[model samples]
Target: MNTIGHTIKAARERRNLTKEELAQKLRVGTHTVEKYESGEQIPSNQTILKLSTVLDIPTSELLKKQNI
Candidate 1:
């Protein structure tokens, strides 16, 4: 899984939101939410923050972890 998948999963769990509910809030298709969770696609920075806000996660946590 990709960074987005991990982040999405964690955030969703934190907010107790299902994929369908997240999709509704994002106003995107459920498939889109699935894709993000499955690492099939990565959203832009703006969308990432929007997702973090909606999911109540920090942007850093939602972003890929940097290698030391």
Candidate 2:
């Protein structure tokens, strides 16, 4: 099952961006990116919107959830 974090990490990797690079684009720190990717945190709606734009993915993709 894919968590939102997994989806985000996959999208980021598809864009060939490192955690630091994605953080820089999102105006967040590298640790924050790690947290997001590790499913230790969730981003705000505003940040999600920014991520959609930066990652060239739909917001729906970021909002997807696992059945569990």
Evaluated with lDDT, which candidate comes out highest?
2
Worst 10 residues of 1 by lDDT: 59-68
Provide backbone clash counts, one per model. 0, 0
TM for every model, in the order presented, reads 0.83, 0.93
Q: Please list the C-alpha lDDT of all candidates, in the order they appear.
A: 0.80, 0.92
Worst 10 residues of 2 by lDDT: 59-68
Q: Check candidate 2 and list the clashing pairs.
A: none
The runs of at least 3 residues in candidate 1 whose Cα sits more than 4 Å from the true structure, single-residue gaps closed, are 66-68
Model 1, 1-68: lDDT tens digits are 34768779778987999999998988888999889888778876777878988988777877766221
lDDT of 2 at 28: 96
How well does candidate 1 match the true structure, expressed as C-alpha RMSD?
Answer: 2.8
The candidate that achieves the highest TM-score relative to the unseen native structure: 2
